[model samples]
Target: MAELRTLARPYAKAAFKAAQEHEQLAEWSQVLTIAGQVTANKSIRQLLANPGLEEQKKAELILEVAEDGVTEQVRNFFAVLAENRRLTLLPEISALFNTYRADLERTVDIEVTAAFELTDEQQQKLAQALSTKLERKVSLAASMDKSLIGGAIIRTGDLVIDASVRGKLTKLADALGS
Candidate 1:
């Protein structure tokens, strides 16, 4: 999976550059979403892997499935992938493209899971707090997870702040051990 990401990064960067050059963030995002959805569906997976079908036929099926959202440029891009047998990288490309988009927009998605449901005030405050810490606009999604026991866990990128009772107990145990 990591190696696939490394291989897909260049393609993703090139796609992002092209999209940025054309001011096509929304367009590319939509295209990638559609492509990712299609690629992830079991039917599409079977189709992509079907050996009985010819390569051109498989490529045509992909284009057909993607017709609603794909523009001419995207179709051409898909054609290149079809020729190169790189269509399986759509999922990785979709993901990396989003990473670039977030970087360009200076935005991050933050997930906050609390033991109990957060009030509107709490949610807004948390978003504000995280925005300050991250120094970027935060797109926050908060939810209740009783398994957390108490408090909340905040995750953004590689940084995680665990303020739950469970987390504190573990931390205290580690502190005592060390």
Candidate 2:
């Protein structure tokens, strides 16, 4: 998986640079996402893996599947990937490109799982707090998990804040066992 990421990074960076230069980050993001999903399909994966299929044909199929989102820039990008047999790396490329876009936009997506639905005021307060804490614009996606009992768990990238009652009780039990 790491090797795949390593291989995909340059392509992702190149795509990001082109998108930034053209001021088409949003459009390119959509294009890449659509292309990634197309490449991830089981039948598409098998087609891409077929050694007998020409690279140009593989690129064409991908472009066809993502026709609505494809632009000349995206077509060129796909051609390059197909030439290098890196079409299978589309998913990783899209993920890396999203990471780059988020950094550029100074935004982060956070997931909040709570015992109950959050009120609008609470959600706004949490978003403000997270924006201040992370020093980035925060986009909160809130969901409820009754099993949490109370409190919430906040997740952003690799950071996790487990404030749920279940989590606290588990920690207490471990401490007592120790």
Candidate 3:
């Protein structure tokens, strides 16, 4: 994982620079996402590994088959990856590119975990509260956990707001122990 990040950094940086220069960051994001997804598919891996196919031919076939939004620039990048045998790293590249996007946007993804699923109004209120507190828009990813028993926990990077019943019990237990 760490090694993959180290191996992926240079390629991601190069691709990000190219995308930024051409004002195609968003477009490339989608393109890379699709390409990454394709590369993740077992059938696609098998196809890429076929001994009967030429590398460039395989790449071209891929370009045509995964033709969701194959722009010339994205095609060139894919060709470069194909040539370098780095096509398998598309998922890491996408992850790095998203990190770049988040850095550029000064936003972080927040997760809100609750004992039960949150309603739309609850989500909106939580987001609004977070936005006001952080002074930046928050993208909320949420999950339900019955083990939490009650309340919700909000997390954004180093910040955490744990209002869970489990947390409260832990606090009570700790206090009694102390």
Which model scores highest in TM-score? Answer: 2
lDDT of each structure? Answer: 0.83, 0.94, 0.82
Per-prediction TM-score, please? 0.90, 0.93, 0.79
Mind giving the per-residue lDDT tens digits that candidate 2 earns over 71-142? 789889999999999999999999999999999999999999999999999999999999998999999999
Candidate 3 residue runs with Cα over 4 Å from true position: 65-68, 133-135, 155-163, 167-178
Best by lDDT: 2
Q: How close to the true structure is residue 71 of candidate 2, measured as C-alpha lDDT? A: 78
The local distance difference test score of model 2 is 0.94
Tens digits of per-residue lDDT, candidate 3, 5-59, equal 7887888898889889988888777777777787778988888887787777767
| Order of candidate numbers by TM-score, starting with the best | 2, 1, 3
Error of 3 at 37 (Å): 1.3
lDDT of 1 by residue, 1-178 (tens): 9998997788888888888887888788878867777887888888888778776676677667656656767776777777777777888888899999999899999999999999999889988988898888999999889988899999877889999998998999999999
